[model samples]
Target: MVQPLSDERAPLEGVIEISTGALRGETRDGVARYLGVPYSAAPFGDRRFRLPAPVEPWEGVRDATAFGPTAPQSPYAGALGELLPTVAIPGDEILHVNIWAPSDAAGAPYPVMVWMHGGSLKHGSNALPGYDGATFARDGVVFVSVNYRLGAEGFSVLGGAPLNLGLHDQLAALRWVQAEIAAFGGDPRRVTVFGQSAGGATVAALAASPVAGEVMRQALVMSGPLEAKDPADAGRITALIARELGVEATRDAFAAVDPDRLVAAQAKVLAGSSPLGGGPAYAVAIDDDLVPVSPGDGLSAGASSNVPLVIGTTTEEYRLWLVPSGAVDRITRLHLAIGRRAAKISAAAVRRYRANRPGAKHGEVFGAILTDVLLRRSEYRAADARAAAGAPTWVYEFAWRSPVRELGAAHAVELGFVFDGLAGADSVALAGASAPQSLAAEMHGAWVAFATTGDPGWPKWSTERTVRVFGGAGGGATVVPAPRLDELQELGG
Candidate 1:
């Protein structure tokens, strides 16, 4: 439970009164930090599987000093846990938002950037240390990170339940920011919603949502999948979970089941599932309410047509999954055949990829194909659609290889640099000890600049297919022609 402020007249150091109530924040290094501020009511018991409800009003100033309980998730086992640090405080108060603002607002309405963490839509929490927003605050921006439901609690497509509860949770958080961020010296009009991976996909989906209206002024999608799963696909996963749990795939049954048991059942069902080739068991569903169509198609049809966008993926996003798991060297012709079969791409498509990287190993070729099919191709399609619809779009590719483990600009590598959080050990593990500080400065500055103004210090992506490549072998960022345009076109980008 949130602690109420004492009635005794103590100095109000970092108190800000907003719509719900007053919040007392903590000050650190010239920045005001407010952690675990509830944006919506907890989705447990009677509210399970329902759309997010408004946060109930609270009395007095609530202490927002400590991180809130993260949504329930299965623990990451072994080295994966070390590589991606997650916070898993068990409790129901999971629909919370963390804010980092400059200590001295001075009546300036700073541009606001809302970050959505990525964990394939099943894992992840905002409490991760690397997601700390003090750097953005220090750089003259108000940064807000949110925690939403995950796994079965968030994405299971139960009968008679509202679909995409996690996305709805995000929309609720955005609404909260729009209504109340001004108290923290943030401009509600200058909001930029940005995220990587699943969060990135959420950003795109939100932009395409009919309810978005003028709520979001801009968006940035980093390594987020653009294609949403069909409703039938979501149903299959729900049925699979239901079969495993020995219950009906309905909201009442799921709500009655133990939450932990449901989470464990979801893990078991998804253990052998592959996210490649549109096989995500739990992801954004193509529900007409929140996501009316494929995000790519919506962008083409002028959904959020006025919202500018920054969209891109890492140069080798698949390496993050393949390299650490020792699956790269083990990939064989059978694996390629399976991937090709799943994606329904022709042998000519495989030949094109192989020709581009002459003498590449079958595993390397397989990883590249997955990277393009699952990430890069979708990014290109979304960007092209948005640009065609007259929304200014900036495209980029993070090409910096991790000096630590040859991770080669894998998915989520640019996160530390984006947040200007290279000092953290978790960050160093992915970015390497000798990661260039200059690149972080440049990339972070560009994000800030984009939030402030609708440009990211590069020419817009047009028919020229221009992209800003950050951190190549020589240790500097560059603006270059986008590689694999033909491959993307072949993949129907």
Candidate 2:
């Protein structure tokens, strides 16, 4: 139970009763916010590495004014820290949900959008200022942001433990929304689950998950990696981490390791590896029950056929990693060789990328290539699969180049525009002060439209392969045939 606020601030919004109990949400700028509402019990001690359990009922109104404890994570040091500022309020109740609703939404059912944050499934929290859902709430949507376990606590495939505990946390939160969001003026049947990076991948997994079972009506994946580590690869990662901790790769041994030490060891093991190698080292493990097959294959095989999807990636998604880590200038022929081998692309494909971007540096070329293989190609595969399954799919490419450091439409750049929060400090830092407001309005509107009506004002992705491009000279959006399809196909295969 949350301690009642002691400050003498004026009473904000009146209380509303939910399934668990009554909550008095604070009001801000015409939106009523119920922050830090626990959706699941604390995952610690015996519950560590186990599936999430339901939150127990509480007496009296609980205070939902402040942000809850963030999932324990290491700080985002150096360039990553500056680029992606994350808050680490260590606590056990990390599996919580925050809500933003229109003040006048009591009498009507609003389309619900549940946001899952991205941190490579390692580091991130919903408390980030950029994730504020007030704008969505004010726009007649019930917006929810959720927190789940991260890193070892969330993703480690321990013996005698459930796989994808973080994902299970997400599923539990969605169930909570279904059972409780109506009290907050949300339509449970119209839920749209959208996420970026790891969260985006989770959106894909949830769509393919048999256990999810109609929890979401639509899904939007932004720069989500579409592949999961092979079970053998996951075993290797588990063994490596276990060795680092000097413990057996089992639930009992890992649960005994200090969470802080375990996180540090996880970081140390991943350090100095290539982006592709590092990300998959801690990626979603393909499990028989949670994820029977890879999202791409499952979608192709008609999983989640009834759920419409809006999925795409930024034009320069890799710059987010390459530029920040200074890997852009450090690429060598050896690195390119490894990248080519991993992507299984031919020399002609490499030449095509180089020829397409004249005067590009080696690192830039390599970054672009990695971006296509790691991100764009996955999106294409998923989109293609959905199209083939006769499911409605809309594809987009964020092309708005940030004026700051030529970060040209890199990964996570489209987030601010999607949330209509270009003015946020984090967004401005990456997108520059002159980032287009009109473009944000358009992109945000499209997302809202998709959530409300399952259409983002574009033709479905079919054999024609049409895509909506957001960000041009005057910040206007245009539908054009997908670019570089031949090269992307070669890279994807």
Candidate 3:
């Protein structure tokens, strides 16, 4: 009943105080934004590859008018690059955070949402215009987007260094939010953390962590994998990168290599890897303290069961990987067989998908099957487990098919809508010129509602498995009793 960027008030707002000192940001369209605020110490010199350290206290109000550097990483390669826009800022102290809040600042203490972006744990930053928090701030929420170490410096498991440094960095940022968000008129107790893809997967891992209750009140995992690898399995990617750099797979040896060079090697080693057959890609690893097990397994086992959660996937997540690269066309019957075997998909699942999508090519069928195995099914199992424990969980699907590139509700297409950043160039690159504002409003409103009230205007997931389908055929939103219940059930997730 009651509510609520730069594109639409004034500029150069005022100062807000925190533990570090003071920050001066701008107010545009009634939203005050503090950009490029450091939440951790610089990870260069002797600190490289170590756990995130506390930020040194400042002497005066630091200028937070511009975004800080992004984590060291490479841009998307090939056709994927053309479709996904990336921002690459330089420097070693990339552990930063961006914030947006209502200019009036305080009332009931606005609901807070912290964003972790998805880029295979190697790409993306809070600086991207598409990740801007202005819209969220305008809607009565204090929003944050965090930049953590990535690639070798963050995720690479090495001798003499902590594993999952990336996740640890995020944990540090959350701790900072809990301590300092009230300065920006944000309620520390009402924090809701959400992310897409790799970011989403990280959110799941965090939800399963013992410290989850100390930081965030809720979590939303969007189009993310649910698996965690053992140290040996997860470190395989690091070993390959070390081999490429001609060094021992240890913290000291990698500390000598330039971040850009390591990023280049990361791209080279990961090249030609498909979504299904991508051998040893970066993923969250099980550790004794942070994430003790895979999120899917841990979550289904009732870890973090008290955390209200929302989990969903785009209708065609794999199509984002397969369609633009022309890989979809090259898929054949043999490829399907190998994929089915590797994914453990049953013959019944294959036949079920084919029947559901009549006249579908082999690539289409394969993409559908791969999406379920790699994404949808695991999330469903997590939700089902939480539901059985009497925990509140909600499910939804981004079904709006993008006209550009025939991406049918593909991965990341929902992001522009979710953030209400459809006009942003990065979003338009995938969603195209003529996207729908009403649809964006619908999805964005739901996320806001979820953050504000823990109810996204939809039924809670239960034995019924109700899912709200957002912005597909006939437009607007619809609540359905499991849109593809038969196919999903047949898939045996």
TM-score to native of every candidate shown: 0.96, 0.95, 0.96
- Which pairs of residues collide in candidate 2? none
From the highest lDDT down, the ranking of the candidates is: 3, 1, 2
- In order, candidate lDDTs are 0.85, 0.84, 0.88
Could you tell me the lDDT of residue 119 within candidate 2? 88
lDDT-wise, the better of 1 and 2 is 1
lDDT of 3 by residue, 1-493 (tens): 0001123222324866688776778877888888888999989888899999999877555788889988888888888899877898877669999999998844549999999999888888899889988899888899999999887788998998899999999999999999999888999999999999999999999998899999999999999898889988889879999999899989999999988898888888888775565676888999999998899999999988888999999999887889998888999989998888876778888888999988888999998888888898888898899999998899999999998988878999999999999999988988998889999999999999999998889999999999999986878799888788788788885
So what's the TM-score on candidate 1?
Answer: 0.96
The digit string of per-residue lDDT tens for model 2 on 1-493 reads 4435336633435677777766777887888899999999999988888899888877666888889999878866667778788897867889999999988855469999999999888889899999999989878899999999998899888888888889989999999999999988899999999999999999888988796565899899888887777667766667788998889999999999988899888878777654543443667779878888888778767888888989998888888878877878888767887778776778888888888889888888888888887777777777777788798999999998887766888988888999889889979878887888899999999999998888989899998889999995446799888877877865754
Candidate 1: list runs displaced more than 4 Å.
1-11, 277-280
Off by over 4 Å in 3: 1-13, 106-108
